[model samples]
Target chain A: MRELLRVAPGGAVDLGAVDPRSTPGLPGREVTGPQRKEWARGQLTLIGAELGRQQEMLFAEAKARQSAARPVGAAAGGGGSDAAAGGAGGRRVLLVLQAMDSGGKDGTVKRVAGAMNPLGLHVRSFGPPTPEELRHDFLWRIRRALPPPGYVGVFNRSHYEDVLVARVESLVPESIWQARYDEINAFEREQADAGVALVKVFLHISYAEQGRRLLERLDEPRKHWKYDPSDVDARARWDDYQAAYAEALGRCGTDAAPWYVVPADRKWYRDWAVAHLLRETFDTLDLGYPPAGFDVRRERERLLGSERTA
Target chain B: MRELLRVAPGGAVDLGAVDPRSTPGLPGREVTGPQRKEWARGQLTLIGAELGRQQEMLFAEAKARQSAARPVGAAAGGGGSDAAAGGAGGRRVLLVLQAMDSGGKDGTVKRVAGAMNPLGLHVRSFGPPTPEELRHDFLWRIRRALPPPGYVGVFNRSHYEDVLVARVESLVPESIWQARYDEINAFEREQADAGVALVKVFLHISYAEQGRRLLERLDEPRKHWKYDPSDVDARARWDDYQAAYAEALGRCGTDAAPWYVVPADRKWYRDWAVAHLLRETFDTLDLGYPPAGFDVRRERERLLGSERTA
Candidate 1:
């Protein structure tokens, strides 16, 4: 039953075809076809099931911890311990995106990132840079939203837009925006070296998909508020945006911060793929309880007695 | 250092003065001194750093369980499985307030409730109830937001307002609103009998405290967006609202959903007290991991390989 539910109709897309070198602007090109295919097929079920299992286990564990009744600081190392030492010694993740209206950013954040601990996860949606943000560098606002140690921070639409959308629409001079790709690569490299796991996903959907979603939003009364007519103008720049994405992905697709060209034509597959990738990233972390040997009984008893007295 | 932090100046209020036998409409003779003091102390530390430690532990446990990579059905019995099995076995805490405009609901939620899994924790902030909500019953919206099974659900403000604010402000007739106390008591008794842990905290603050907060909002540019002059009308009826709270708390104070009048004069103290109460409630659960003896390795290997052939 689980197997049947897990396997989607289209199956996993070829990651190599979506690779940067294969096809610059076009969507389809297969490199390392057989090997990548075999690898993806071999790992898909195990990875999916493992992700689901982890989510459930995490929920159960959180519930149990709530019931332990231990003094808060006692169970999680000593008081004043940094979060990193309290069993969350993992590479922090930061997700950056540059999406047009009805570009599925909200859905991506919810479906891809919803299961994460709200405490350890930060979602910052950058509307527009402030005057202060513009005074320094464009990356300043983005820098402020970076996740702390052992946390994941997601940007709904990110600094890439200073090059992508701004370039496409001539929002900034070509000279000013063109240099950002290298600057971005350097900035991401710094974060990677600083123990931040970066997985940049571009929800590569066709103009047709964007149109269908926009229409659906209009049809659904609940989503009607989200519809904007100006999105049509953005849609007209489809080729320009596609070229920009290809260039950005090509320039910034380092071993440190690889870009995944997600086939977001299928929302379920996109969600599953993102979840699988996140699980893989977190699995690489060596998170566990601190080595136990602390005597918390005295503190616990004292606190309880104080409670009773109060 | 921990002891000094724990024993900081604030302590729970005395509730001894509360008389269970007291009839409704009695002026301000609500809570007994001891109970009031205990309640006060509990609220003071609801979101203190101590509580933050507990939250971190819960998340850490969840992360560990997830990392172990067990099967979903069986993994539910992993670390902290006791909470899953307990299934609504502890006290149901409900926090009530007038308006959370800037009354620290988000801060409280993050500090006190951020640690628990979303599955076992729920928050429902009642804005103007939908037409559908009002059409059914006053308690309809409130009941819908109650925590399921073994979990905690916090109400920014609660059903008491239908009587307190609506009565004092003449939003509803006195005869109609007055009868809600018995209805609420009966409802709470039903929850208590079913092992629902019920805690009601009225975050009390003087008009001066509120005025100071409002002034801060106006002074700070970032917070300017949050201020609403409409709050002055609510502040004008401060004395009337207090009388209503005193009456309602006195009448509805039961073993099931006991009202704890917390002093919100100090934000730190309130956060600490809430966390303390929550910790106390969960400690009573005696939760632990379920018995585990399942072979997951074989299944994992099989699943990993099956996708290749498909």
Candidate 2:
């Protein structure tokens, strides 16, 4: 199931070639309509429950290992040992979402991530860089928002926007955005070295599906607040965005953090697939509660004795 | 209770004159025995409840006003208007704590801050500067850790160490550490301008109390991990640390963020007093939920439409 969706390190992935309506893990391409959804729904319920349990286990492991710092110079990526210094208590997951407008990035967070504990999850939505953010290296703001140990961090849109949007919109010189692809690969590799389980999800939605979603927003008065007229301006350049995504997924996918191209036209399927993908990512970690370091009996006596009055 | 403990901006504060054993907010200094402990415990409970409630309100207000950015150039320190650009969602409290060895900072956090919502609280303990941190200006690391709007951030020890430890220990020459007192004041004033409410606490423990606490750590087997032999070296220079604290508290206290001398001989009283002090600080912010901007009726209809099937 994971291999079907995963973009192998250094492998070529043509975004235009992938179908947005296809569900890679679900059986029978012939299955359609409500029956298919019912199957997806059942899978989603099971996945959500398992994901929640995994999240709790990770959070518990983090607390138990709070005082333990990672051993200096742990081997980078692909250590056969189950133990990881960065993965110990401080290991975190950064779920980076990149897509064209109306790709349902925010909806995925609301439906899938909202099910998890807010205490262990941090959701940071990135828009245009602020003036202060622009002054630093492209990765500065992104680095600052990376989830601390024991957190599942969701970046609704991420540093990839620099290469994707910057290239498509001609916002920066080609020399710059072109260079960022390698920089991003290197950065993610470093995060993997430091005990970060990195997952990049490119919500691959068709151009026709995007138009429908955008129109729905326009027709609904409540969603009018969310409807940005600029979305139309971006839609005019749909082919450009597709090219940008193809280039990004192809060049940036590495062993440390591979890109997953999820078919996102169906919001329900998108949410379900993301939940499953996340479970697969977390299953890779060898996590557990740290052993008790303090003597409980001796401390109990001291707290109950003269100190209680003193 | 707040005024009794607060050191007014620019007011003369003699650390040597204050009694570490004195409970400033509690009544009847003549009171002793278990009765005094019970009274202190009662006050701590009351203060804890109030502090918890205040933290919730502040967090709620931050969500309500998330979209409302502080108006450009809102008044610094004191402003009569209820609407503040920075205060709309970004108002945060940075509690800077400075003290001598065994002065009970970790205890203060465990007792006082432990009562508040961990979701809204961030505690960063600064130690010797890393090579990367040293490359930047002294305030660089401090600024990065400031709680993003609507958080209560506690600095177990803060930038004041640049002056206090740097001066007494000669980690930096007199020429450098001497200049930081004014630099810190200006830096805090900038935070005030940005809608950050700042408070500085100097946990004032007498030399005799510090010795007792250090002795307790050694005698208790469970606490042996916390006791460092280096603490003895710092203890040897007790008077120098005291003089450094006096200068830091005196010079850095300002209208934007004043320093408070917290009596730390009695652990319960210290926790109760700091909790009370935080409640007073939060009360100053005019905070509430941001008004609902989306049309609830329209959103409900859209959710129920063909999109549910699509």
Candidate 3:
């Protein structure tokens, strides 16, 4: 499944070659049309329920570890650099999503990641940088938004914009934006060392599809709020954006921080693929309920005994 | 519904008088037994979906308003006190849940709030305050975790802990904990003035039910992770905690932040009631999608025209 979507480290990606409408095969064979959509929905429902348990397991592990790290009578809440992270530390996962307008970044999150316990999930969307953000390094705000340990963080749009949109719109000078590819690489490397697993996804949608989506938003009174005129301006430079995306995806795709170009013309397939990829990531991590720090046998006696006392 | 559950301002609360197993009336009359559970489940599912839409509407409006508030060429991201809040502002909501151990707070979040978009929902669980957190006012950390506008925030445990556990366990001096009821009311009033709505809920359960839950946890290996020894200690003093809760609920039940005593003996009823309450909250807000900031007709032309150019 990953082989179809994942770009290898140092791999050259040609955005034009990949079919935006292509749906990857599920386990045994490719399920198509209505059946495929139904299969994906069923799988998503199951996956969502499992993800909820997985998150709680990780959270329990974090709490146990945090308690262990704290000195007795020193008071709860793990201290040190981790103090800022609300006494949580352990394995973390981040999902970075980049897409052209109406490429279903929001849809992917709502469908694929929505069912997970929000306590263990953090979703940060990056649009145009604020003036304060501009004053700092490109990765500054991204750093601030990174998920604390034992969390699954999703970025609707991310630092890739420093290279993609920055290059396409010439928001920053050529030299500065060009240097950012390596800066992002180094930044991601640090996160990886810090026990953060990265899943960078590009929801690949066609130009015509984006235009159709934009038009639909404009026509539907309920969706009018989502229709931005600037989206059209970006649509007009579709070729430039595509070129910029190809370069960014090609340059930033790494073993530690891989990029998956999910064909998003079909929203169902896009959602399924992302969920599948995320489940695969969790499968690799040794995630399960952490053992109780206290003696369970002793606790059981105390718990049952307290009933008599009450 | 509010009349049945709400603890009116300055009202006397007798925790012993209310039946933990009671289910409130629906619109007209109450549904009972299995049928009631099924009905609540169906209602919860429908309410969850609608809440998702309402949250998106509020988010859309917040974005629109934030952009409008910024000066031209301001380079997006609303600046000011709002800058730290991800540029989101509008109607905010806080749902604070309190209960004895095994009161099904986590279960309610899973069954009710699970369907909402994680991007717009923030859930914070307050355990024992950290050394640093204890150094400041009890409300400091609570204030930090308050949901920004356009977001629904859930607190698994909250400031009520100051009066409940602090008084029950004598963790703080009597004078300090006694004064917190007014302090909490003032804090919630400030939040109300800042366009925040508060729904403080106590998941009331019978002592026998809690014992049954604890024994189940003890018996099941998978559930052992959650069986803490301290929970038994807390359970031993159940009556004291109840008294503390009764006092806090009576005093802090302001016009702005009403406290609801949710009968949580039936897990299904507890989830259904909370979801219903949240839906009623959203219903009161003008939560349809915000109107487009730009000319929709002109954008529609530009969107259609882009297809030709592409």
Candidate 4:
């Protein structure tokens, strides 16, 4: 299941060759058409429930651990640092998603990730850099947004934009964007080392599919507000964008945090695949309900024998 | 419904006199026994669903507004200041819960507030301040935890602690805790002026209930982790604690952020009351789905003319 979508470390990736309509095999065989869509939807529902429960277990465990570890006189407000309150330092997941405009990043978060416990999930969509952000290192803001332990942090568009959009759009010098590839791989490796399970997903969609979606946003009354005229200009540079993405996937894919090019042409499939990938990520972790640590008989006696009673 | 539990601004409140077991009338006459518990449970379920949907509307509207208002080239990471991204400045909810040990603050959050979308909800359980925090005024940390627009922020235990625990425990001198009542009122008024719907709840549990719950924690192995030996010491000082709470509630309760003394002996009733109070708070606000704001005809033509399509 993990291997089906993973781009092996340093594996060469050609965006032009990988079909945007391809749906990876689930367990045994390849699923397609209506049957595949139905199967994916069912899997999504089941996985959504599982993700919710898993999050609860992690939260409870973290809360208990935090209670046990809090220093004396520490305030009881739930404003402690994420690492302290969340507990189990390395037990977190960061789903780094990179895709072109109209590639379903927002839709995937809304339809799939939205079903999970929002307390345990942090979905961050990156856009253009602010003046302050440009003044610092690119990864500074990314560091601030990393999911706290026991959480699943989704980066709607991640640091890869430094090498992809920055390269294709000439936002920075060639010397800078070209060097970002190494910096990104190292940064992700450090995250993986820290026990943050990194799942980098490239939502793969065709040129025509993007155009259609952009037009749909324009045509639909409710969605018109979401359509941006600037999106068309980006679409005009589609081939160049593809080449930039191809280089990124090939250069940055690593064993610690492999890139998965999910088919974004089909919304159902794309959502299901992303959800499935997330569930599998959780499956690999040692997550469960924490042990009960108090003396049951003595406490029950105390409750029953309390001098002052409700 | 709003009138049922609200403590009129500056109203005299005697903690010793307010029955912890008093159940306010929901609509009609008071209900009793098993029927009352069942009734509260039903309301809890219904209100939970409404809060969830209302949150979605706010989130969608905020997301749209943010996109429209984002300064070009804003940083792409998720760590931007909340005020900037969650536009409309004052469209947010902050529920502040202050209670004695085992007062069901955690339970109320889990059973009622937990049902809302976590994405739009910010739960901050304020603990003792860190050394750095102690250097600043008490309101410093409280201000840091205020939720941005389009979100519901819950302060498990709040600034009132400065007057409540700090007063009873004598952690601070009379000179300090004495002035906090006015400071607290001013801060809450500022929040209300900023458009934050503030509801302060004092989960009024009987002394006996606290003993029973404390013992339950000690007795139950799973809950043993939550039992603090110091809790018994606080229980011993119940009378002093109550006086502090009564004064805090009476003095700080204002038109902008009235305090509600909820009879919390019955877990079912407590959960329902908090959920109901939150729903009413939101009810007073003009929250709804934002209107669609894009060109329909132009977009429709673009979609029809796209050569490559989904």
Specify the highest-DockQ model's number. Answer: 3
Output the chain A TM-score of model 4.
0.90
Candidate ordering by DockQ (highest first): 3, 4, 2, 1
Give the runs in model 2 whose Cα sits over 4 Å from its true position. Answer: A1-128, A132-140, A144-186, A197-310, B8-12, B26-90, B110-123, B131-145, B148-150, B212-227, B265-268, B293-310
Residues B1-310, candidate 3: write the lDDT tens digits. Answer: 7677888778568989888988875543567556877888888888889888888887777767766665654332111113235434367778898898899887887777787987777777777777788899999888877777767888888888888877877788999997898899898998888888788899999998999998897787777666666677788888888888888899999898899999999997898888878877777776777777778778777677667652
- Candidate 1: what is its chain A TM-score? 0.69
Model 4 lDDT tens row, A1-310: 5677777666457777778887776542666556877888888888888877776666656555655666654533232224223324646788887788888887787667666765466666566666567788999778876776667787878788888777877889999998898898899888898878888899999887887787776655555445665566566677788888878888888888888888789888888888888888878886776665434565455445547533
Instruction: Tell how far residue B12 is off in model 1, in angstroms.
Output: 11
lDDT tens digits, residue span A1-310, model 2? 5688888666457776789998788776666777888787777878877776677667555644543343422211111111112233368777888778779786786567755654456566665665577789989888876776777778878888888777877778999998999999899999988878998899989877877887776565434434444465566677777878887898998888889999999887898889888989889986544443444455444333322222
Clashing pairs for model 3 are none
True contacts kept of each: 0.01, 0.00, 0.41, 0.19
The model with the greatest TM-score is: 3
Which window of 10 residues has the lowest lDDT sum in candidate 3 chain A?
A75-84
Mark the regions of model 3 whose C-alpha exceeds 4 Å error after superposition: A27-30, A72-88, A308-310, B26-30, B71-89
TM-score of each: 0.44, 0.56, 0.93, 0.83
Runs in model 1 with CA error above 4 Å? A1-90, A98-100, A296-310, B1-310
Count of backbone collisions in candidate 4: 27
Q: What DockQ values do the models have? A: 0.03, 0.05, 0.41, 0.26
Q: Can you give the lDDT of residue A262 in candidate 4?
A: 89
Among incorrect, acceptable, medium and high, the docking class of model 3 is acceptable
Best by lDDT: 3
Q: Write the per-residue lDDT of candidate 3 for residues A1-310, one digit (tens) a residue.
A: 7777897667458888889988865653666557888888888888877777777776666666776665554432111112135424367889998888889988888887796877677777776777788889889888887877777888878888788777877777999998998898888888887778899999999987887888888889887766666677777788888888888888889887889999999887888889888878877787877766678788778877776543
